[model samples]
Every structure is written in C-alpha cells, then in structure tokens.
Target: MRSSPDPALSASSNAMLARARTTFDIEAAAVLGLKQRIGASFVQAVQKILEVRGRVVVMGMGKSGHVGRKIAATLASTGTPAMFVHPAEASHGDLGMIKPVDLVLAISNSGEVDELTVILPVVKRQGVPLIAITGRVDSTLAHHADIVLDSGVEKEACPLNLAPTASTTAQMAMGDALAVALLDARGFGTEDFARSHPGGALGRKLLTHVGDVMRSGDAVPRVVSGASFSELMREMSSKGLGATAVVDREGRAIGIFTDGDLRRQIETGADLRALTAADVMHVGPRTLRADALAAEAAELMEQHRITSVLVIDAAGVLIGALSINDLMRAKVI
Candidate 1:
C-alpha cells in the first residue's frame, strides 16, 4: 500500500522508542547514583523502624501501592515485620490495622495522595513514626514525615513526559536499598532466614541436619568385624540401604561396603563365600557428623564425589546412615 512505505521512513515512528530507551537508561543510572544521595536521614529511618513496637504500615495510592506491596514483602522476608495498607482502605475501618506504636511508610510520586494526606494528622496524633518517599524534597508528605527519602527522576519514560514511570522505578529501588540496609543492621542471618521460611526448600536445605535425615541405630546396615560375606549380604538386603558400615568390637564405624564395592570384588574374582565384612569393606568411606547441616552434608558428598554417608555422633560411634534419596525427600536438593 502506498508503495509499501520505505523502511527508512520509520524515523518518526521510532523516535518514541529512542526516547523510551533513553528514559530507562537514565532511570537505571539514577538508581545506581542513589548511593551518593543517602545521608543521616536513612539511618534515622532505620532507627525509627527498629524502635517501633508495632508493624510497619505502608500506604500508597494506585501505582505507589504496587511498589509499597513489594517493599512490604521485602521488609517482612528480611526480618522486619511489615504489611501494606491501601490509603483508600485505611480511611474505611481498615485503619484499625495501624496500631498506636506502628510506624507509617507513605509512598507517593507527587508526595500528595489526597487519601494519605487526610490520614497524616491521625498518624501524627498517635505519636507514630512517619517516613516518606517522594519526588520533591519539600512536598507536603516530605514535610510531614520525620524522614524523607528523595526518589526524584529527571524525566519520564512516557513520550508526553506525563507518566510516572522513571520516578516510580527510582522509588522502588530506594525502597529495596532501605530494606537491605535494615536487614544488615538487624544482623539477619541464614538461621534467621531459615526460621522465617522453614517450609521452603532453602530452609530445609540449611536447617535439616544429618541426624534429621539419617537412618539410625539398627537401620544403619552395620556388621561387626568378623561377619562373613553371607551375613553382610543379609544385613545389607534387610536394611535396604545401598551400603553397610563395618564396625569394630566397640561398635564404632570402622569402614563401609557398597554396591560399587560388591561390583569391584566380583570383578576381582574375590570369593564372596569366604570373605568377611572386614576383608572386603572399603576402609573409612565418607562419614558425616550427626549435627552437620544437611546442606553441608550435600556439599561434602559433592566434594568427595559420593552418594551416601555414614552419620556418627560426637563420640564417633556409628549412629546412622544418610543416602542421597533422604536428602531429596527432605528437599535439600
């Protein structure tokens, strides 16, 4: 149609795309440049959060609400207890969620959501801490908050420059910075993360110990030093574990034999009928402490290039066996 419009004539149509790209690059650079903008007010905000006896109540309108939700989730997952409240909903009975000792985190591009502004007096009257994220340092919300985090952006991604795209991105990045800062300040550790996410895969990997997954005592597929090959086979088959531990007279693990060992012995033409547990067992197969973390055991198995491990207690007495399957079942994989 119309001579199929020349490909070179796509300039005006592509001008908006260039502007959008430039806007995004500038926004990303602005986020990276935030390190220089942070000051003592950031520390004061953290102190306000730490001292608050109640939950962090985050309120925003429209697009700001979306960012607030993410910020609340990040804060909650990292040790600080926070929840999002819609400014509109807060006016209607939902305000009850805001306790007197709570701290309010209000987010707005203009720093003037009518709903949030209306509730400002209430927050202040309760003696609650108020922190604001806004594009203008002297905006109403900023003036009201005890600490104001500037999230200004030079331009918008919209071609008309009317949308709040880059400004919102800058705000979201600042919220993440605050969350991580508080996480470090609170001394949030892996153990604390595990406690928060006990049912998740990472939690099981970090907190499930060798003792938690190991088959213990009689189920360890162990035999004494003098047990014959026939006795070893019976013990291995009954226990259903791939490997059997070899122990001394004192009932401590001395060595181990597995399906691999059986294959090697068969290849070597060793007489299975005459061999004893001590004669054929591979000495000192990979062993683990009962108290070792399941992730540590997994790492050890990977490091030593093995599948199964023997679990021994503090006294070095054979207590149990842990197989790769046990780790998978515990979600340590």
Candidate 2:
C-alpha cells in the first residue's frame, strides 16, 4: 500500500522549484543582456581572428577557464584553429606557446584576474593580438586588448550574488558567437565539419558511401536471365540477401527476384518447377550508383518498401549490392 504524503516534505519541494525557476530566469536574462552590446567590437574580434595566420590561444582562470576550454574546442571544430592555455600556467613557460603569428582570446568576468593580468604585458610584447571577453569594459584587461567583447551580466544567479553563474553563461555565449562568426567567414560547410569529426554520427552519414558499405564481387547474389528456378533460389539462399539479381550476359541487372514474389506465386498455385529467373523476376528494380551516399540507399529502400538495392557502375553493370542491414551495420542509418 502507498503511504500518505508528508506536508513538510511537500513544502520543501515547492521552495526548491521556486529557487530553480529564479536561477533560470536570472541566467537567461544575463545571456540576453549581451545582445545589446554586440556591435563594432564583436566584428573587430572576428575580423582579427580571420586575419590571423596561427591558432587562437584561449586563456582564463577559475570558472572562466572552464568556459574558455569549451570555447576553444568549439572554435577548433568549427574551422577556426584554437587551443586553451590556462593563465596560471602561462607565467611559467606556457607563454612561449603564444607566438607573434597567434592570437589570444582572454576570458575573465572581473577583468582583473591576477594570474591572467600578470601575463598580459608578455603577450603584448610578443605582438600577439589579444581579444578580451570581460564584464568590466573600463578595467585593465580591456585597456590592454586589441578588441573587447562586453559579456557583462547585471547580477549573479546565486542568492548570495557571489558565485560565477550568470557571468560564466554570458562568457560562453559570447565565445559561441565568435566561433559562429568565424565559421561563416571561412565558408565552413557540413563536409568540412565532418572531416574534422570522422568518428561522430554526422561524419559517418556524410563520409560513408554506397561503395564503402555495399557487398562486392561474389558476395552479391546474382543469377543469369535464363537461369532455372533452382539456380535463383540457391543464389538467394547461399548469399543470404533474401533476393537475387537477374543479370544479362554482360553483367547488367535486368530484373530482381525476392522471397515475396515466391510467396505470392505459391499463393496463386502457379507452377514453380518450369519457371526461369526472367519469368518470375520483377522488372525495373531500383538501382543506385556506387558513388552515391549510403544514406541515399537507405532512403530508396524506405520509399519503395524494399529491404535491398543493387549497386551499379557508369555503364549500369552490377558492381555491388546493399541491404538495410548493411546500412545498420555501418551505422549510416
């Protein structure tokens, strides 16, 4: 049996929900506030990044450092070469990583972080362009930067107004804006992004081709046009494709025979012993080019309500065969 609900516990849950809603409101407002300040400085930052010959060196301290690392990764994957370098480590020997050809994207809410501020002059001395994402536009970091993106928030989402909640969100949003702008400027397309992420789902979908996943050579089940009913059945069963392609003398697919056709013929009480591959096969079977994307093959199967398709060359000769199971195995589906 279910026990009665506790009144005190219910009240506590209500209070927690109210506080969570307040946090969401405050953080959302913080990100929206950034829109008003995006103008010349933001464009300048993008222009500088596009003009640079080397990778973007991102740096920050504390919570800002975490945001910076994510920003660096976003920029890198989106076609802008970038890497994160912790400000605290830069003072020791990591400063050497910032060459004259590189650009620095520094993130700090207060614009006065000790670890980050200490290395500004060294970065400037090396002639590396610096773009600052900070709350305080009049602070030292802004003064030293070649371009300053204002990511200031009105207040922290924390009740104590001390934790870097809303401030960090604003910084991350600003970083995303920069990465998107750079991606557009470089004309980075889906194929380019897929090349960088070859192991991901989008990469698999875009990079995988019919030629890569289709069964080639003897693995494809085939029978000549004049082949007997037994030959067609044996070819389909041995290859386990549930179907057999009836090819002409020059290896071009003329028709296809499947188990469905056999079932229908059996239901009609037709003579199966005297039939050849050409007599029972379905004419004008759907075929795809070998170089077409595997995704196209899956679409063809789904649209025509068929489980398999034959791959062909420029001359329409049977080159390979693909099945829905083949697409599933390659993770293209």
Candidate 3:
C-alpha cells in the first residue's frame, strides 16, 4: 500500500502553477499594449522596406538577436527579402552585406547596447535607412534611427524584474506585425508561399495533383458492363485496387463493382456465376476529377466512407484510380 502524499508539496506545486499563470497574463497584456502603437511609424517601416531595392538587414544582440533572426525569416518567407546579421559581426566583416539599397532593422530593449551603438555611425555614413525597435524612444539608438518602433512593456514577467520577459515578447510582436503588414502590402499569395516552402507539407498540399499520385493507364482496373463475374474478379485481382470501374463503349464510367458490392451480393444469396458486372454493380458511383488536389481526394474518401475512388475527366471518362493507400504512400494523409 502507498502512503499519502505530503500536502506541503502539493501546495508548492499549486503556487508554481499560479506563478506561471501570472507570467502568462503579463506577457499577454504586453502584446495587447502594442495595438495602440501600430501607427505612422509602423506604416513608414513597411513603406521603407517595400521601397528598398535590396534586402532588410536585421541586427541585434543577446535575446533580442534571437527574436530578430525569427523576424528576418518571417519576412523572407512572406515575399520580403531579409537577412539577420549580428551587431558584433557587422562591426567586423559582415557590414559588407549591407548596401545603400538595403534597410537596417536594429532591435534592443534598452536601445543602448554597446556593440550596436559602435556600428550605428558606419551604417548612417553608408546612407542606408535605419529602423529601430527599442524600449526607450529617448535612447541613443532611437535618436539616430530614421524610424522608431516602441517596444516597451510595463514590467518584466520575471519575479525579480531583471530577466527579459515581457519586453522581448513586445519586440517579437512588433516584428510579426511588421512582417504581416509587409506581406499584405506585397499581395503575396498561397502559390508564392508554396514556392518558398517546396520541401514541406504545405508544398505537398498545394503542388500535388490527383493525376500525379493516382493509378492510371494499365494500373486502373476496368471492365465492360456486361462482363462476367470471373472477368471482373480477374480485373480486380490484376489491378489490386479492391474495385473495378464498369464502363460503356465510349470509356465513360457508368457504374462500379467493389469488394463491398461483392459482399452485399453474397449476403443476398445471389448466385455469383449467374450474375454479370451489371447485376452487382453500383450505378452512378462517386468519382473525383483528375486535376483535383490530393487533400481533396482524402476528404472525399473520408466524407463518403470510401476506401478508394475513380478519377475521371471532363466527359466523365474514367482515367485513373486512387485509394487511401495511395494517399498514405504520398504522405498526404
């Protein structure tokens, strides 16, 4: 038998959970506070990036640097050209990555990081526009920046009020806001996003067509409407789609004979050898277009409680066959 747990430990666990909740509330409020600050400066930042011929050069230090890297990635993926360069590295050799056609986006909570300040003059001398995301508008970085985005938070989420918590969250929200605004301004569409992420699941969803993954030509099982039970069984066995399309002389699908249909026929005490394909076939079976998406195929299969479907053309001619197994093989499921 197990002994009872200590009440003091349970109380400590509850106290920790409460502290976490308080921290989340503080961060949520900080992000909400940014809504009032998306004004003229934010618009100006978007306009400046759009107007620039070169990429957005993002620079920061410490935790701010981590947030800036994500901002740059988001901007790049959303149709804007952008890259992240560490302030310390920029002061050394990475400064060459910045050009007059490019724009600089520097982030700092205090707006007075030494590594960033040292390189600000060089950036200004190069005639590049500067956008600053900082906590203090009066700080040196903000004073020299061409555009200032205020990322101040009321208080740190840390209990000691020393760690970067709410302020970093505010900065990240500002970055995301800028990325989304620029993305909308550029009119980036789903196809463009698919082009950028061709190796991911999104690419598979947007690029894969039913024709690309379906069984076609000899792989598709077909039988004439008056075909005998032995002939239908041979086609099903040869093609392995667990179903065969019953077509007319014009190659148009009129009905389907499936494993389910065979089972229903047997359950009804029908003589298998006496029946032709028309006797056991289901008329006007569900079919999908060959140009439709693989995701669409998956949805149709699940919605109609089917394991496979026939792919047809504009004239309702059966051209291909697809199954849930094909979708799983293509990783569309």
In model 1, how large is the Cα lDDT of residue 213?
86
Error of 1 at 315 (Å): 2.3
TM-score of 2: 0.96
How well does candidate 3 score on lDDT at residue 291? 87
Regions of candidate 1 where Cα sits further than 4 Å from its true position: 1-20
The residue pairs in collision within model 3 are none
- Model 3 worst lDDT window (10 residues): 1-10
Please give the lDDT score at residue 172 for candidate 2: 96
Question: What Cα-based lDDT does every candidate model obtain?
Answer: 0.86, 0.93, 0.92
Give per-residue CA lDDT, model 1, range 77-105, as digits (tens). Answer: 99999999999888898888888889999
* Each prediction's TM-score versus the true structure: 0.90, 0.96, 0.90
Best by lDDT: 2
Candidate 2 lDDT, 93-175, residue by residue in tens: 99988889999999999999999999999899889999999999998999999999999999999999999999999999999
RMSD of 3: 4.1
**CA lDDT, candidate 3, residue 285:** 84
RMSD of each: 4.3, 3.6, 4.1
Q: Alpha carbon lDDT of residue 66, candidate 2?
A: 98
Q: Per-residue lDDT tens digits of candidate 3, residues 108-195?
A: 9999999999999999999999999999999999988999999999999999999999999999999999998988999998878988
